[model samples]
Every structure is written in C-alpha cells, then in structure tokens.
Target: MRFLAFLLFIAFVLFAIFARWFFICDILNLCEEAPVEVEVAPRLQTLQLTENDSVLLSGYDQFAFSKGIDQPELNTNNEQFLDTLAQMLTADTTKSLEITGRFTPQEKDIMAGFYENMGLARAAAIRDLMASRGIDENRISLKHAITSDSLLQEPLLFAFALNDLPSEYATASYRFTNMTYSDANFPSNSAIFDPGEAFRNYADSVKVYMEAHPEKSIRIVGHTDNIDSEKYNLKLGMRRAESAKEYLENLGITSAIETESKGETEHVASNDTPEGRQENRRVNFIIE
Candidate 1:
C-alpha cells in the first residue's frame, strides 16, 4: 500500500509539471500571435454639409401638390418673374441670411430646441415669397410645416408627403432667359422693375419674414458673380442691394434694415458656369 501511494504521488508531480509547461507555452504563443494590433481609434475626417443636401422639403403645400407651380407663366408683356430674379441676382451678396427671433408655441423640428422654429421660419419665408409674388396685402395666410405623423408614415393614405410641396414654385422650373453677371454687356432692364428682379424672392421672403416678427432686426449684403472687375462688381452690387433695402424700407420698416455690397469675393458658388455664375451674383440677409 505504501509503494502504491508513492507511485501515485510521483504521477501527480509529473501531471502538475506538464500542466505548467502547457500554460507557459500558451502564454508565449499568445504574445507572438501578431501582437493583437492594439487598434488606435480611427481619426474622424470632417466634412461640411450645406442646405443643398437637405432632404426635408416642408414649406409649400399648394405648390407641392397638383396645384404646385413649377414656374409662373411668363407675363409676356411684363416679364415680372424674370425681372425679379435678375434684380435678386444682381443684389449684393456679402451677407449670410438672417432670420429674426419669433414668438413660439415651444416646439422645434431639427436637433431639439430649433427644429420647430427653423421649420416654421422656413414656412413663413415661403409665405413671404408668395406675398412677394402678389398676394393680397391685407390678408395673411398660415400653414403648418408639420403634418400628422400618420401622413408621413402612410403617405399613400394621406395621398401626399407635405414636404414634397414647394414653398412658392418648383425651383426646378425657372423662367429667366439671361442670367449673366457681367458689366461688359448688360441686358436691357425691363420697363417696370420687379421687386425681386431675379432669383431673390427667397431673400425678400426672408426679409419679409423678419419684418413680420416685429421684435427682430435684419440686414443684408450683396456681391457679384465674378463676371467683371471687382471694383465695378462691388459698386453694382451696392446699387442692387440698396434697391432691395429701399424696397424693404418702403414697406414701413425704415430703421431696422441695412444693406451693403461685397463685390465678387464671398461667393457661395463657383463662377465657372452660367448656372454657377448666376448663383454667385446675389444678396443675403443677417437677422437678430
């Protein structure tokens, strides 16, 4: 019995030794196995997103529906819409757009505390644009930028996505003929001036929206589209900017409005193409 017990103890020692060796070998293998690439967190490459890429289309309901106007029928005799776009394009554009603070019922539409205000503000802007296009001055129209969640979830049931409606007209259906921003050759100015003159009902709408807010102030700047000398562009930019300013001033808003010109320096678009050049020659507003 003692001999058997001694033999068992010897076997236990060998087993223990083999177990230690196995664990040591495993530890060594783990260290050699590609070092587990302690992955440093990947650096984030930042990029900018602008208004053009946004998919939220809420603004104009009638215009988004079958009744939505892509472009107004050119007033053949007056060409009011084209002329309006032109004036808007020529207006100074150094300033970024501004919207006045508003009295709110306390809901936002974007990333909280801003989404509703922003959406309502945009809708108000569309209303102002329609007004610029000749709505009855005494009557004010109101609509919600929001729709029933059911409308969004079951678009077929609601028959339309409210955002699909345009705010004034389809931006896709523009009616202007000449959109160049050069002093080398200017097109004949229309006999009568359109308040917007070019693609600027948007700007005017913003101005009008600010004015509607009553407590807020607004300012605007203009710039050229790089079709001429910077000096000439600046001066030209001022004329159109002042023109817009004066128009707003005449709307019984004398003091809170300001205007200036920035020539061709602060362009939001490239001046390489006719389309882009048209975009660059413009005006914008700042609000407080």
Candidate 2:
C-alpha cells in the first residue's frame, strides 16, 4: 500500500508540473512560437521614360495611385521630375512622349463618360496634367494596358517609341463619374468575359434602370471579328451573348434578357489590326 501511494504521489507531481507549464504558456501567454516571415512585394525604385532607345527621364520616384483609383498621387519628387521633363521636352523638339497607363481587372471604369476603360482614363489624366505643366499636348500620346500585376501600387508604366507626330491638342476633361454601362470585351476567339468592377457597376446601374422601367427588357448583342467561317463566327457570337446574359442574371438583374449575334457584320472599329480586332470582339448591352 505504501509503494502504491508513493507511485500515485509521483504521478500527481508530474501532472502538476505539466499543468503549471500549460497554464503559464498556453493560458497566460508567456511562451512564443517561431516568428513567421512575411513576403514583401517588389517595388519599382526608379521612374523611367525613354524615347527612341534613349532614356529621357530616369531616377525619379515611381508614380503611384490609390487602390482602385486612376488619379496618380504625385509626391514632391514626382513633381520635380515632371517639371524637369517639361523643360527637357521644351528644349528637345524632336522627341515625343507616350504614357501607357496600367489597370488591374478589379478596377472599375469610373471615367466611362470619357474613356472606354480605366487604363485609358489613367493615361489621359497624366497627359492632361502634363499639358497643364507646359508639356505640349500634341507631343504626348496616351495608351493603356490591362496589367498582369495584381498587387501593383503604381498603375502607370512608361515606354517610348517612334510614331507619327500630330499637331492636335489633347482634349480630355478631368471630371469623372461612376460608369453607368460598359461593353464587355472578349479575347480573340474567346467567348468568356471577365466580369470586373466595371461590369459590377454596370449591373448595379441596370438594376436601377430596370426598376424604373419594369416593362422594358434588356438585350445583349455579341460581335466577333472576321476570323473563321460565317456560320462558326455566328455560333461563337451567340455563345458570347449567352455568357453576358448569364453574368447579368447572376448579378441580380431580373429584367427579361435577350441575346443576339452579329458575327463579323457590325464592327465599331476596323478589323485590320490586332487592337481593332480585340475591340470588335465584344458584347454590347442595350435596353429594349
């Protein structure tokens, strides 16, 4: 009996030790685990603008923007860089500037009243700002790209190349309002469209319009470039229209939806260039 009592006491002591350790470490927060390392995103250290294989503006702070916004937030360094660039362009008469603005798929086309996409809006905004800074608006060309970087803080990417010089002045207004509607663009020979923030905003606007006109119905017409046979293109266009209809239905639009296909027939732009073809492959929303 004595031996058993001693064994019980030993077990109790061990349990007490473990219980105290657990109470201190787990309950009282006195212990720490291994520190976790976080991965940081790489940022651009320099802002560069080149022309005809030569660097014009270099070693400036990268231009950044607020998340989901098109307006660039310029710091003192950025302003200085711009002032220097304006002076350089004034001195050099042969060189021209091209501003290519970038936008992620998540950004909305808030400047739909002026530009077709957020990327174009951003580029135009920069061009107008430069114009106000005494840079010749005729010497600057605006372009846009759908950026691949999901975590990109700076949405403007700059590069230079030779292009035909024009004498017209830039004429884009700075005011912006939320996009009420936008065309859903598709990739080459693809029917699926990315229902981005612009699409969501358009759906919301449609919902409002639909509530006011309950008897009105919605129509989605899909168009395609001249790529394949007429029959095949028609079928592809129909698929594209159906895809848009599905997106609208998922976005809580209860109005009657109609789908049509105008394959390679009605195009807003010439189908000669790749950019034109991309623009041609789109689905337009119409209220009927």
* Deviation from native of the Cα of residue 213 in model 2, angstroms: 32
Per-residue alpha-carbon lDDT of candidate 1 for residues 1-288, written as tens digits (9 for 90 to 100): 999999999999999998887787775553344556575332222211113344222221111111111122222322332234224323522211111212222222221111122333333343345356554212322222334432121111001112333443211101111111222122232111133222234444554566568777766566677776889888877876676566666655644777678778776556787746655565554565
Query: Model 2 Cα displacement at 167 (Å)?
Result: 16
Q: By lDDT, who's the top model here?
A: 2
Off by over 4 Å in 1: 1-193, 196-215
- Model 2: per-residue lDDT, tens digit, 40-127? 5544667887765777677777777756676787778878977887787777777677777888777644544246677877787787
Candidate 1 lDDT at 199 equals: 26
What clash count does candidate 2 reach?
0
Top model by TM-score, which number? 2
TM-score of 1: 0.34
What's the true lDDT of residue 46 in model 2? Answer: 72
